[model samples]
Target chain A: MSAVASMRDSILRADTRLSKYHPLSRILFYDDFDEGVNGWCELVGNHAGNLDDIREIARDFRPPQLSSCTFFDIGTHGSIEGTYSLKLATRAVPNHAAIAIKRLTYMRRGLVQFETYFTFKAEQTFDRAALSGWDGNKAPSERQFGDFSFSNDICDGENGKRYMGLVRYLNTDVDGNLVQKWMHKTSVQPTTRMERQGVVPPNQDFHTVNPDDWEEIPGGNQPLCFNETASKVNWHYLKWIMDTSRRRMVELQCNDNVMDLSSIEVPVYDGHYHGLPNLLNFLLDVRTRTNVRNFLYLDSVLVSVDW
Target chain B: MLRRSFTAVLEKNSTFTSDFATEPYEAGWALEARWFVRILEISPGAGLTMTAQISPDGLFWCDEESGPFCLNEVGLASMPLRNFGQWLRLDARLSGKNPHVKVLIYLAVKG
Candidate 1:
């Protein structure tokens, strides 16, 4: 039997190693980027389809097998360390930062967890707001994209709001059919709506806008201030869990830290017309221009479901 | 499962409101609902009070018998809507010192 078939059988029969811990089947899919990066495709703006472009980038940037394991070494443009990380430059052609792929049909009611390991390495100028030069001038204010993201078309909330906001979300229909729906702003904070229109209303006296130092209240969210690019060279483990059982709660774990993004609406978007979350993808985005090439090392992507 | 998303962006001390009109409930589909807050940006020591209200008519609204919640840190502040009526909306009131918290309150209802 094929590898996919064998794995599917093991999961369905509750014969996998994880079966010992949970009564339900686990490990729907696992990828070490060993299959030569053929499983993922590229997406830019709203145009999404095919895997040709992604394969090209992968082949050009693929590094030697890591001793006993195979992994993707992106952004190895003749660096002394060879292919060490995936370099997603804002200046690259197509200017796309996201990739798409499909996974097995895991019940939406079950807890879907996407776990991976990554490290972000960029020039000190990455966070220009800090200190770019001796003059101590702050960097321009622009929307920096997420370090990593996972989006599927299962959510159908708002269409037009996709491009205008930091993230995109398509609406899901009453019968669970996917549709492109436009949501209008009926009730919104006057100031936030104004800020969206390029106007900064006066700050509320009780609110502080900018702060000199940010204190991590002990158990804060993952990718906390300590995980910034300048922190360390150690690999970081990140996990995102979407629990649709009771209240669609999301738990994010960065190493030992945990952030419960409670009562969240649909966070992912699906420009693709597929009605299912077949587009279970892991993406790295760099929205602003970087002075030097940056890197993000990806390894061991996994997804588990209650069934 | 069927799910929908509703968002409310909060400002400092200002109560941001969002009204979500869902589709008529259909038989055979089990229903579930949750609320989450995505911290886009916030001022130091920011806290916000979130309340969900239900109404038969969009105009006349009352607190969701079981829907008042508060969140100090970022992440999901989820609550399941057990027995809900038709028209549902959320209110987020920023509080605390310099309580400038910019967060997106997302309401996910699934059946």
Candidate 2:
């Protein structure tokens, strides 16, 4: 390595906050929830002046919160770094989802990387169903969490190609059976325009044209640490890299597991979209399988780019 | 630094014919909160009774100390709140025969 490059790496390693992240050439933004929710907002669907025009599936993605990660059992568990984290919470209704997005525009897209420490949980239920034979190590609440996803919206330019690159962790299927796998979407996201044109049917899953249009990634069956309780919170580190020039995923790293995503197909919209140019948006969402609220919490986020 | 504030649209053009509660929102860091309800359309002689609710955790909730706010006509109404615990939501009940109301709800918090 060059002397200048070595010196820069040494300086970055000395900084405690930046040490945990392996950033690209340029650090675009670093959001520490200790300060506040930095530009992260609830994702609302495109609508005219009338909110009634919003698609049913996209209407009620609940608002994001600055959570202290507190619980009735432990009071306040706090965040990894400070007192708060950005939280997206679903309602206690089956299939209900909550989403949060951070909007940005890229100057030049080569390679963009997003890194965060996040955790997921289902709300604590007082009443428990009787179990015939139970293992004490596994918590039932783990099966209540349907899924959580990371997705992006990128538009080349006006009247240009628009595509979404997404990855999801399915904790349980609709029947409340634990799946514990990572999956990628097979169909393009159904947009309001597509529905208006009668080209797509009403969607149950917000990420794809149909609820079943998802396939498990190869070797993606990995169970995360639920800590055997609903009240206990354990944060996991995730880092995803996407190649914008090629419009494809590079890799995904969760904790010690690294998966190559270069072969994953990223579905693009066939119809041209207007009014969006240089668009770059990052989204996070959580869904519940049973009538229990699910939550996704991010302690911090760092976005960098090699432009 | 200036005091941080946020305004969340809890409900937007939501029509309800029966009793319902807004989604729970976490505002433990905020010292003050306010609720804004905009009644877009309501059936003749129909009204809504809204009560501020607080939760120790996000799961269970109880009514706040302040009395409920009543909306009897089309327009906007706001309720200011203080000393509310970690979570906040609005519980609304429809009144008058076969009543239905379309409304927008906003929660503003500052710390």
Candidate 3:
């Protein structure tokens, strides 16, 4: 069997060796889609097709309050011979301000059918809101080009002032369909609408921007100190952490514990190397398929991030 | 302050020596003088000095002799500092029955 199939079977069976590496705070679709999973996903506008098919299988099960959560996946692409569609629902505390979290991972096996280079076909999406029912206007965060700056604009609740933010989400639906949805600011916060899922604020990302350090600027409708580049990247990265689970989350030894587990996966794909160079790829393909075919490894993980 | 390509390096090793160094200030790279040059590894009793030798292109020199030091007012030799920093070179010698046989030199420039 391919590595992908080997990995997926081990995970689905909750094999102790692999399961021990991921101590899930809760399992939303352990056996079948449970009412609790449906209830919480629905709170964020997720429906039958929105949660994984397994969630439909676990329509009545539930778990407990979370201190922390870890996840893993060993699967393949939709067409890859080793692809196994695995879905999990659990609490995720992403940062200091997180109230709750839900994470999902769709992984494809690394194939050396022709060469050893791991090929991954994966996609994930989710949403969030910083605050609620505020008069603050939003611009939908347009695509930032060069030298972007954020003006003084409050996006979260502070001093009882209301500000609602929305995170539009798009993900593969339960029936293998893809869906788009949106959630109110607090939808991803401390408690899910049904209070079944969320990071619980105990294991969350930063709750509030430091007023003194990130004061509002004189610019129109922006934060005191905001970089479109840094902000957007960080937001998406955090979003990725919030919605995706990896194959090995225990690798991170952070004392605080709020970390991105998907980061630990044995790469099936990546986009680094100071921006991938396409010119040498043809040569790489030839070499990778020849003497290097079965020997192809991820070579390295792009874990070092710049903020 | 608006600083460009700003960098900071406290000191790889604090062994003061005689060398003219320049770097950008991190605090006030915009308008305020934040890019400060410092001399490290100075003796307590050994007096510190930075003679500002100026040249049209900073090659041929003339001494303007004024620089800061991380030494006490009573003179560096009077009370040696294990590590030191200032916007000027620290001209001092390390001696006395102590074990400091190896010293490293470093420089940090605004790139």
Candidate 3: CAPRI quality band: incorrect
Superposition error at B71 for model 2 (Å): 0.7
lDDT tens per residue, model 2, B1-111? 989888889998989998999999999999999999999999988979999999988778999999899998999999999999899999999999999999999999999
Candidates' chain B TM-scores in the order shown? 0.65, 0.98, 0.32
Tell me each candidate's TM-score: 0.37, 0.97, 0.18
**In candidate 1, what are the lDDT values of residues A1-307, reduced to their tens digit?**
8998678667756844233222224776655442323244333222134222222222121111111111122211221122222323222222123233343333445566666554443323334444444242222211122232333323322231211111111122223233222121112112223344454343221011221111222234223222323323345566666554432436656667665545444332224233433223334333212233223445445667775
- Per-residue lDDT of candidate 3, residues B58-83 (tens digit): 11233333443333223122111211
lDDT of each: 0.37, 0.91, 0.20
Candidate with the larger TM-score of 1 and 3: 1
Question: Compared with the true structure, what per-residue lDDT tens digits does model 2 show for residues A204-244?
Answer: 99999889999987767889998888889999999989898
Task: Give per-residue CA lDDT, model 1, range B32-87, as digits (tens).
Answer: 55665665556666676767766442334577777577776756566667566444
The C-alpha local distance difference test score for the whole of candidate 3 amounts to 0.20
Clashing pairs in model 2, backbone N/Cα/C closer than 3 A: none
Model 3 stretches astray by more than 4 angstroms:
A1-307, B1-9, B17-29, B34-41, B50-111
The DockQ figures for the candidates are 0.01, 0.80, 0.00
